[model samples]
Target: MATTPLRVYGGVTGSDRQAERRALFIESGLELLGSPDGEAALTVRGVCRQAGLANRYFYESFTDRDELATAVYDHVVNEIATTALDAVAVVQEPERKVRTGLARIVRLIADDPRRGRLLFSPFLSGTPLVHRRTESTRLFTQLLGTQARQVYGMQGSTRLELLSGFLVGGLAQTLTTWLDGELDATEPEVVEWCAEIFLATSEFPQQPGRTSIHVPDGSEP
Candidate 1:
């Protein structure tokens, strides 16, 4: 069967226009969700106004505000993760890789306080956003664990997973406080501390005592 050519209006195809609208809505979502107003700017009307689109266009891409917010959140998370992964992939030394990856995260958020607020701010902790954050944390936990194992030439173990969770969760909370202006430290300083934590946590304990930290894969959590 032959495919029909796309219908164009004012020199743009119907699909092109639709994708443009979706991108606009996502951008508006980022701006609003990260603004000082936080999730308060998540109303359909507010988002529509910010995007300069009719209310109908919002439904074209997202079912509601939460869907739009999820898209916005996913966009930020994917970009950060991809950038960090790429940064680490290029470096040969593990410490350099860790520092380089972490520096990208710190710089990205520091350069845009809006992203920092959108990500780790207490004000943005609505139930849906919280759920999404939890899911994203699990993803990062897996990524961190995999990278640590590869870098250190270690096999998967329960202890490595535990340390990864602790480091990822701890760093997120630290960034939250830092973004909230409670840390009283510079962005580089925060990156340094976090890199140290990552490096130290990546170190494996060789000895097994009566109450050792390392549990075999089948052990209880």
Candidate 2:
């Protein structure tokens, strides 16, 4: 027997064709969400307008705006995670891995300040699915700690946790500032400076419980 087609708001279509339309809907939602005044409010009708689909098509993929918001957030987070992880994947040295990963993150933010703003928005910070950003940051922190353990024999989950949150939070705030128009530094310059600060803080030889690190001036990539 052939499988029945999935329905969006009770409208049915072939599975493959439905998936394509859903993708288009999601992409369009993201574009709208990343707009200059996007975070003010998002509605099903607004998203439908952006996606150029009938009101019914909005429900084909997402149950509501919150659902669509979650999907868009996930898409943005995945993009950042992939870029950072891929940077670390090709490096053999711990310092290089941290450097490249941090640089890649800065570059990603620089590539699209508006997208960065939405990705780092405080609105996405506390919700359940929205917490994926924090989870990803925690994972990166753990990865860095694991790397440090293998190389420097620095071992302690708490220490690593602190380091990870500190570094990721710092980077997040810095990128937020840039995206919010509070910074004047170029992307390359920002990334380079951040790498130095991050590596220095990450590898502080003796301080095992430090929570924050300082960024130095004149540090350019």
Candidate 3:
């Protein structure tokens, strides 16, 4: 069978106009993913319609459907991480930072149901990079490990790894539930709930027994 030449929507024409069109094409693909009528089983044709481009245009920018999906996933991840990290930047205290980060993340997901669905859903199973469990695990582990060392004064790297692994599991499960529509709270309410969990739980561990300690200023031990 003869293959048709795929034209990518907003394909680069080496001109500003082409760049603008390509941006529009990418944005349109995300919009389609978020549309009320859109399902998780998205396609090149569907994205083309959403972007108002010819089906052939999809190939001009992407090699295949999997490539397109990877682009969409990268877009969503960058957007979410940038937004959430911005919210966390001003937080000075480690505990507050963790709380604010989680709240911001949950709020982001709640605010954009489509993005939440994309991040939490299984649609990326079609893509190789996005579907790798080991990669996902490593990323989450690093995030949580940093939080532990910075916030809790976790001494050893091994300890940080163990704690981070447990914390990431909780976070991933929580996000997956939020994405699956298992929670019915407002965004702020969700944020508050997430904050409470983060603050009181071992996920963002506080100093052990320090909560009950009373050290006198004039005494030297």
For candidate 3, what is the TM-score?
Answer: 0.70
Which lDDT tens digits does candidate 1 get at residues 104-139?
A: 988888888777787788789887889988989999
lDDT of 2 by residue, 61-172 (tens): 7887778777776777778778888888889887788678878877777776656856676654436445666666776667666666765677666667687678777877
Say which prediction, candidate 1 or candidate 3, comes out ahead on lDDT. 1
Best to worst by lDDT, what's the order?
1, 2, 3
Assess every candidate by TM-score: 0.87, 0.77, 0.70
Which candidate has the highest TM-score of all?
Answer: 1
Which scores higher on TM-score, 2 or 3? 2
Residue 163 C-alpha lDDT in model 1: 84
Please give, for residues 87-112, the per-residue lDDT of candidate 3 as tens digits: 76788887778778877777777777
lDDT of each: 0.87, 0.72, 0.66
Candidate 3, residue 111: how far the Cα is off, in Å:
1.5
Off by over 4 Å in 3: 1-15, 34-41, 129-137, 200-221
Query: What order do candidates take by TM-score, descending?
Result: 1, 2, 3
